[model samples]
Target chain A: MITTSALQVRFGDTTALHPLDLDLPGERIYGLLGRNGAGKTTLLSVLAGFRKPSAGAVLFDGAPVFENVRSTSRICLIRDDGMVGDGTDNLRDVLDMAAMLRPAFDSGYAAELLDRFGLTRKQRLGALSRGQRSAFAIVVGLASRAPLTMFDEAHLGMDAANRQLFHDELLRDYLAHPRTFVLSTHLIEEQSPLFEQVLILHEGRLLLQSDLDELRERGVSVTGPAQVVDDFVYGLKVLSERTLGPTKQVTVFGGLDDERRALAGRYALELGPVAVQDLFIHLTGGVP
Target chain B: MRRFPIARFLLSTHLPFLVMVLAGSYLLVAVILGVAVLVSGPASVSAVDVAGQVLHWLAVGYGYGAPALLATVVVHGRTRREFVAQHPVYQLVAAVVLAALITGVYAAEAALYSAAGWTQAMQPDRPFAAGDYPMIFLANVSMLSIALVTGSFAGVAVYRRDGAGALALVPAAGLLVYGGAVHGFFSLPFAQQGLPMAVTLPAVAAGWVLLWACAREVPLGNRVPA
Candidate 1:
């Protein structure tokens, strides 16, 4: 179990992560999505114990994680560029060191992942392709089996097909072993289904961190006569509204109640579910 | 009982030892080969003489590489920055302890050479100046200081989000200045062993080291290299 309480991360004059609290427990996927500079990486760093929060603290199983080897050794963080081992380009040496340092390291799984990705253990990482390097990072994160694992931009340099493969492999591994997995990505549409909870960061602040299913339920477009739709939204929180021909469609925050659904049915108003991307666009106020 | 011993975590960082040992051995081997092939005039040297030269200078150069190698091993890990912040005091102490080991080994050898006439047959007059003998000591201290500075600098720089570039550049930059100054002003004539030079230069190395160390105040995790 892992939790961050009032964690604030600042770099130089820019505050990368605003004060926020979060809980990521065992055996589920948590998806983190944000616009550029939304502090997703900063938040993950705190949780993984690779960074200390300017304020607040991250706890693992009721113990503070910062500078605690027991806590950190149990967490694996896979970054976008695949970390270089103290600036050394010897990929095998890095892997060997990782295998040596990490108690739970699954050498077989790491080797298998490397093989599946068509990467030789002997090839120097500097000479490898970007996708291969990202693949190497993914292999380390997954195979390390650190109780709490996060993949930040793990999909970097991955082709569409390879991305899908990574997703499938990650889910399979998680289901079989059942540990924490936080996936941060810009390709939200492809990965949203894999997350039970979604965190949307906005400008160093958490605009939203809640259930993905609840978020999905919040996105309903009700279409009807302009006057009828307007009347229906009188007491509801509207996210967006548009008109087509003589009809109007309004998106609202709360799901329609039984009474409202009945009214829409009787008045011949159409109500349909909107996908996560559109919901995200509404939540972050960013263009879809 | 505390989960990880300071000694264990301290020792775990020296995995680079294997790599460095191999490098040091290769360098020693090349030196032996070069000396054997080239250190000849009207007559060639004997095996014992060759061994004497190789072991002597190696004992001499051991201090130079020891400190840097120890620091490189001590202040290194999965990431450069993590290596430093994990145990700043512990790492420094370990590097100094390893430096002492290199010197201790050489001191023991120096005593053995003096007690026994083994080296006398090879050369009644050693091939080094009196100043050169002390230079080994200077080399050890400066090398260790230089290593700690450069290693710490690289670690701190990597924390600033330019880890790869900084790691590559830190050693080169530090050595460029240190080596340049040593070559130029190390043993200038007509002075009290350039007392100010020794004091000021090591201080400069320490200053460069502390500057990056101040930068080491950064907080980052594996998820965020920054």
Candidate 2:
């Protein structure tokens, strides 16, 4: 488990993270959703002992994490740029260094990942394309097998097929070796299926944390005739709306009570589930 | 708990490459000097006379290598403290190894000069006289050791503070000057051949302390996408 008590981070005059408290239980897959500059990277950097919190304490299983070898050695945070090796180094050199420093690093698994990603050990890190570099970062992150592994925008340059391969590999590996996995990404709908719980951040603050299903249930989409859809969503928390010819679809927060459900049934309006992406857009101040 | 794991890892990974480069550089310099001697008549200076150039190259190498190595090791789950503690061991070993190689080049050059009936003249400012291999090794080791530590300090300073961190080079220059003065590179009034350890040891120690201060709490910056 990881716990933060009044954790804060400030850079010059700008506060990156406010004094916030959180308790994150271990051995679960968590999706950290945030808009750009929402403090997601700062939080993960502190958690991984990459940086010190400006104030308060971050503890891993009741032990402080910053500069604590016992704690840091068990944590791995892979940022977008990989941070695995120098440009001059070859892929094999990086893997060797990782194997030497990280006790849990699985060399065989790393080799398999290299082959799966169509990367040769002899290729220099600087020679790989941006997408290949991201894939290589994923391979290192997964092969490290650290108890607490986090990836902050680590799939930025990957193509759709590579992203799918990464997600599949992540799920398969998690099943084989259960551990704490925190992924911070902008690909909400595609990645939400793997998240057991979701933590949403808005403006340097954690806006919400809940089970993924429960969070998804907080909003409903209504579709019918334009007039009826507007009337049905009247006085409700309307997040967003779209119209096409004579039909309209309006998404609103809060569950529909029985009377509203009956009203929707009587009006022949169709109700559907809202996507996590929609809720994220709405909760994060609606379309930039 | 592992003993100097960072040091061992760094040495094992980088030393072989460094040695190869050093050998290649030595061979290239020897060829150039030999050609010069053949074309211009008996050469006054031996190839090892210019071995001091290695000091600058080593400093540059450490300046660029330290931060990258630190990031790689820290991201791999090693603490900054472990890196700070173990890196000096690698630096010291590298300095010793490089000094020994330079001294060997001196021996090789002495033999070549003898065979060719050329004078193996050395610069007047150097700490060692011609044919004095022991003093040559000791003096080179002291200067190279200081250069390595100072380079690391400057590297970490730049890494932590970006543009403004270049100010560290001022102090780094001061340290290097002191190393040279004591090692007889600069003809200082107080420079004595056998008394260099008095200042050389302290300068190296001070460089290491500065390096630790700059690196201990340094935050790793996020790398921009390529």
TM-score, B chain alone, candidates in order: 0.43, 0.92
**Clash count, candidate 2:** 0
Local distance difference test scores for all models: 0.62, 0.86
Model 2 chain A lDDT-worst window of ten:
A80-89
Query: In model 2 chain B, which range of ten residues has the least summed lDDT?
Result: B51-60
| Estimated TM-score for each candidate | 0.66, 0.95
lDDT of 1 by residue, B29-67 (tens): 446645754665222322322333333223223322322
Residues A110-219 of candidate 1 have per-residue lDDT tens digits of: 88888887788778866767787788778878888877888889878878877877888898899888898989998888999899998888888888877888888886
lDDT of 2 by residue, B154-224 (tens): 88888897553777878888987877765677777655646666677888899898889888988888888
lDDT of 1 at A267: 86
For every candidate in turn, the CA RMSD to the true structure comes to 8.2, 2.1
